[model samples]
Target: MLTLTDSAMSKSVSISNIRLYQFIREKCKIAVVEKNQATDDPSIFTQPKEKWVTMIVNNSFLLNLFIEDIDFKETCREEQEKLEKEKKRLDNNSVKKRPKCQQNYITSKTNHDNCHYHGAFVYDMNNHCKLTREQAQTMTQNVKLIASNSASGRSMELPKLIWDCCLGLYGIDPPCQVGSCGLPNEMKGQAIKPGQDLMTLVQNLFMNNQAAEKRTKDFS
Candidate 1:
């Protein structure tokens, strides 16, 4: 019978070795013929032939299977390493730096002149147009007083007070005026007339409770 040596038997049988042996037995007619010849040669006592030719053929078959297994494992390892490298590269690319303006929006002490301006009390691109802290406080007080008077149904002094807040004494332009310090054209229309009433202005700017609430929150 064909048998492996003690040392060969002691070696572990890998999956590749079994698969290769099955392939050779099923598909390789020439190799099968050669193996049969080698197997029968020993029994026939062929003239001037090597002693263990069948053993050599079996060892060579095992060696080929072992080589195939090693190559397959090495290729798999190389592919895995390439995929890991690609993953790391993509992870590195995914990280992005934030914009300088957005990163320092709240903490930055430096004023940005290019940024849009809203009103006198609020900071604007033109720092010269921005009101001082004292002026802002006084405006807030004036607004509160106006709101109080309106709540009390005191309509007599409202026009004068509103005009003073907009144009006359305070010299503060209405927030709905066009230009850099004013709201966008979509939000505000043509500049306020010399004697436009506060209710009319409020209705024009804030047509909904949501907008009015937002304005109130901003003031608060």
Candidate 2:
């Protein structure tokens, strides 16, 4: 009977090393190193260095799956440190160069123009039209119905019409009270672009509504 030598049979392999090799073989591709004139030896009988020794990790997701939790956490900690350093550097650089409006939104002093004007107009209109709470709710439902129905084709002209109907005011030139209530012109020309037409304004209103709906859904 032939017997194996202790040098060959008694050698031990680490579990971590075995797992790493298995992971690389299962989740990554192995490639042979490209032959270069300086390193390539045609007369050498041995296999190329990269043929059995190199791993090419093309699938990042699979590679991540095989990584140890401890290693992954360490990498994330390092990355977060780097990001914090970068943010500190940027904040210092921007302290003197930041625009006036850059930090205004975070400040306590809000413009409040939209809130004040829009609220005032709505309150006055409720008083002028003698709209009860139930009536206001009904008008809200009607507006939502029109918005839902007008989501396709050339239905951009429906918001103003729905508003007009809800307020019981409709015509080529509506009543002065209806006009003063801020329907169709909420800002009273405060922020209107010089060349913007009615169609553009209506389109913008719908876009704002769509954005608001998306935010609501996201939060929900």
Candidate 3:
């Protein structure tokens, strides 16, 4: 009888390595040709993850079924709760007061000419139509990056949109890269080039071939 040796494992066969598919393949091993039995290679990216629930007896395979984004609505609700809680916490505090005139919604409705000016306040403070600390804090509640529709059950999520920017805001790189945000190495110049946008250049992102050549020349 011809028998395979343990030390010659490389010469022996590995009919199938999939734990899930092992039984079916083993049953077929009785009929499969020797050369065809051990050549199936599994892909790392495409393999199934091992799944099971602990029970008293031997572990058994589960009939896994596919489902859509089950946790999306739950995740949205959680984030919304977090955002509202943060807003509520900041509602009452030593907030800087804003002038009543600046708090008015309409410029056309306000009598800007004679008495009701935009800057007059109860404490004789001037206002600039800016939100108070409390108001600013509360603004975050309504001003969410994720829209309310994002929580709707029927909504489909497109692949997340990612854009390279000098600053992080609204989950997208903000176009406001000048003045005080510590501008990136690229696009920080006084003026943008013709046909070039502000986001085109970035520091350390370009090749340093010339600098390397100079370094090599100096070292030699």
Candidate 4:
């Protein structure tokens, strides 16, 4: 998600950026496919053990994650006990609330004055007091409710190994000092016009190729 401003580096462009363009144009779907794969395991046989472990630890940590920790057993026991207590509490609450919820629903069904709307019993006109089976079905269809924790369906735009691919080596940072991806810290925020059109041009070229193939087939 590199965001460039409205012509920030119009004068000078980074060679690394140009290399990125070349990668997209030449490698076909490598960037896109690798990007998708990297979402779950970015390193994926590429990164060193230390780097991979560091990345994993940074993202998550269990109470007894490290065996080297002094109180590893104690930490594990404590976490287990806490988890049990939380589970018990949830179960007890569910058992206590079930009868109450059922009772309330039964009470509300007979009386149209108040009814549950979005988990709350409301008297507002916007919240219907009571609905026929058909009305309930119709309302449910019209309302566009999103999941509370919806998963992202979109894949990442670029591969995590953009630098590695360009340089034909692993673990090299972007803009390697040896002129790998293009340069080492070449005006960090340069406005790159040629690189900017990389995606658009690649897509256009692909579409044009497909069109030409279809035309050839029709004539044949």
Candidate 5:
């Protein structure tokens, strides 16, 4: 399961930050689903492959946003530096009037402590995806529901997709460009197929749903 470190949690109190974190978690779940699907069924490789690429691109974009917003890299650097300093201090401690065997044991303990801190840092870096395999399967079902609706021309707008799943929480619109507040026009009106790209698929589904709604009201 993905988890925010205490520092990350403390910094993510704002609505936007919380949403960003949630978005990352969801993408991780989706990636897991895509990976499993591709592995299980080679016939649909092209579709899942495209979706996986989209997931990676979008996730990377969002993660960069999160890192910048939360100053995550700086925080990690500071933490690592502190650990290094503590290790150095322990290493430089004077061994006063101790037996040679006792001194060896103390030195070994200090090394063990340093190794433990390093291992923890590595674990924190690696273990961010929070979903179990069962949970990922459930998430796959949800994605398929949306895809099936889209395929049947009964496209339903997902509330979360309205903001491209994350940016709306920051009071921004979809297709935002990096290092700028202005929204990009690259994806505007771009036609996409169901299961091609998750974000675009959802956005297209939303648009189709809106058009259908308007037509219904007009006919009525």
Candidate 6:
């Protein structure tokens, strides 16, 4: 039920870009799956959350995702039931649908090897598949897609933790000389590389002025 946004709604993309998105993601079908169309919430992407959208097609364009803001759960009974139904459907109709002269697609690993697939065919492994290492990787990704993590009930909190450790830990001050409060880190300036001088340093310091000032204050 997620709608494309201004940054991601483009209809045309280079074939390589599309492949990048797909490469990072396992299955595009379920990366943002909805249970039902009518009652489904369209607000998943609008929430203040960091969502990841990986597609093989757009290799470089990692789009943000919209999902339910809360963690959810359901009785496994229905899911199990649907999978069983899918198995039966494939078993009953695959022979008629598959062509005899069709090229073998999923030629990677047997059993779980093979190529990327979707729907009932994914769950029912005996269906059409591609037989290459690439296909194997694709199939692996699809399974991961179906195992979507939308049920988790928290915002994208992990990133906050990372930012806290890397930036907040420095207490909004310089790189060294204890801190505005008192803590110790290596008080020396960063090592310079050969041929790198004031101009290069200036560009780098633009982003870390606070750190430079803090360092100066510390040393003085």
- Residue-pair clashes per prediction, in order, are 0, 0, 1, 1, 4, 36
Whole-model lDDT values for every prediction: 0.38, 0.37, 0.30, 0.31, 0.36, 0.32
Provide the lDDT at 150 for model 3.
Answer: 62
Q: Decide which is better by TM-score, 1 or 6.
A: 1
Candidate 2: tens digits of C-alpha lDDT, residues 35-148: 434546768564434344333555454445445432322234456899998887675444221021112222123332321111111111333332322344466667667867
Query: Each prediction's TM-score against the native?
Result: 0.16, 0.15, 0.14, 0.13, 0.14, 0.14
lDDT of 3 by residue, 1-220 (tens): 1233367446442323345344533443342221223335754234223222222322122211101211112334456899997776565332321122122223223333322211100110122222322343344444443444466645343222211121122223333222212223333465756874322232222222244334333433
Worst 10-residue lDDT window for candidate 6 reads 157-166
Model 5: pairs clashing at backbone N, Cα or C within 3 Å: 1-129, 1-130, 2-129, 2-130
Provide the lDDT at 196 for model 6.
52
Model 1 has an lDDT value of 0.38
Per-residue lDDT for 52-78 in model 5, tens only?
313243344555654464332223445
What is model 2's C-alpha RMSD? 21.9
Higher-ranked by lDDT: 3 or 5: 5
Question: RMSD in angstroms, all models?
Answer: 25.2, 21.9, 27.8, 36.0, 35.3, 34.7
**Tens digits of per-residue lDDT for model 6 on 1-220?**
1224445545533334545445434443332333333436776543222234432323333333211221223335556898898888675444321111121322221222222211011111233221222344465566556556557634331111101112221112222211121111232365657875533343333324454334333433
